[model samples]
Target: MDVSGTRATDENTRPPAVIKATARQLLVKVGAGGLSPEAVAGDSGLAVAEVEAVFPHRDDLLTALVIDAYNESAAAMERADEAARAAGASAGGRLLAVTRALRKWSFDNSGEFTLIYGSPVPGYHAPQETVPPASRTPAVLAGIVRSALENGELTPPRRAVPGPPLLRPEAVELFGGLPPAPFSDVIERGIVLWSSLIGLLVFQVFSRTHDSVRDESAYFDFAVAVAAEGIGLVVPLDDGAHTT
Candidate 1:
């Protein structure tokens, strides 16, 4: 009995788990760029044909890993937000909690975080299947912002000199007027707030800030505060006084 043939048969028959396991190991061992059917097969002990049978190409593997990372990140955000609510935090605090949660996940899972948030995987364009999972984390923040706006917790930013428009006319329809046409500026700031979280992580998690940020944790909290305020999560005057 040839063990290699038997193992190959198992890989061929159960390609889904084997391929997923292979992709996960490849992400940890070689990062996204190193993800290929050959590498997956080599590490997974599957035939190259077996790996390709499931993934088809490197992009397929990348999409699987990307979606996994996105889902995990979203779950982390949701869990952190839940903790914030448990502590009787305001909507703004919940937003900050999710941001901090995701940032912490980025530090812990740097490779996967980079796979999702870092850079594009060169020629690989993620298909539409990735959209919903990819949108979950942003939806978390968007929900908070929409709540703040509806509940009158948000302070609409006053742009000076009436600068050029940021979002297209179509974006209004897409947002379903949550910010409303009158407060489109508010939605714009909401987007920047979302990006700021990612930017902060890229800076800290990727070592771009290195010596520039001596206390990254404090800086992150401070930045989260700024971003929270940017989206109109106000710290009550009494609460502020009590903390310091």
Candidate 2:
């Protein structure tokens, strides 16, 4: 889609697509603050006026990039989940699958990943419009939780943990309202699962664990399996043992 929210056809989308493609390249070299209509135009071989025609303001271009990154990352997870479902994998298996897919995407597209998940670009506040695409990845996680609950793959904690509701009204509504009883705690666990997934990816992507961790891929599976247990999922680790 173009900045105007209109779906872009082949001919029209080509320019914005080219512009965005070029902008992504620039994001690596110059960082977000360095992005501008003139920079994209120069790198893309288009006139500055043409770049401005699509993205008159720099933030418009940044928003488009942010939206694209979220969508592409979410698409990877969604694809992984679909494949796991087709293979009759359990929800725990699907959780591992999606996180693995996202991990691969983050490594493959570190620049884009960092663009969205890395440090905030100075002076840029994401508009409310970014919310939907931003929600897609976590929504995928929530779907896995819902399926697990329905299929009897996940059990809520037996005892009510003493605390207020983990999710606010809006977040609860967004996930199709709270599940009954302690089952709602499962949703909170799903949230932690999502956060830990991203946190692990960030640590790996930024090379924060390179010194201490050997065989990152194996380590990721182990970590995600551990996280799954927090939500009552029983994913198998690399050694073929389920997380306790």
- The TM-scores, one per candidate, come to 0.81, 0.89
Top model number, lDDT: 2
lDDT of 1 by residue, 202-239 (tens): 99887887688677776777777787776557743223
How well does candidate 2 score on lDDT at residue 103? 90
* TM-score winner: 2
Count of backbone collisions in candidate 2: 0
Provide the global lDDT of candidate 2 against the true structure. 0.83
Runs with alpha carbons beyond 4 Å of true place in candidate 1: 1-14, 160-165, 168-182, 235-244
Candidate 1 at residue 68, lDDT?
78
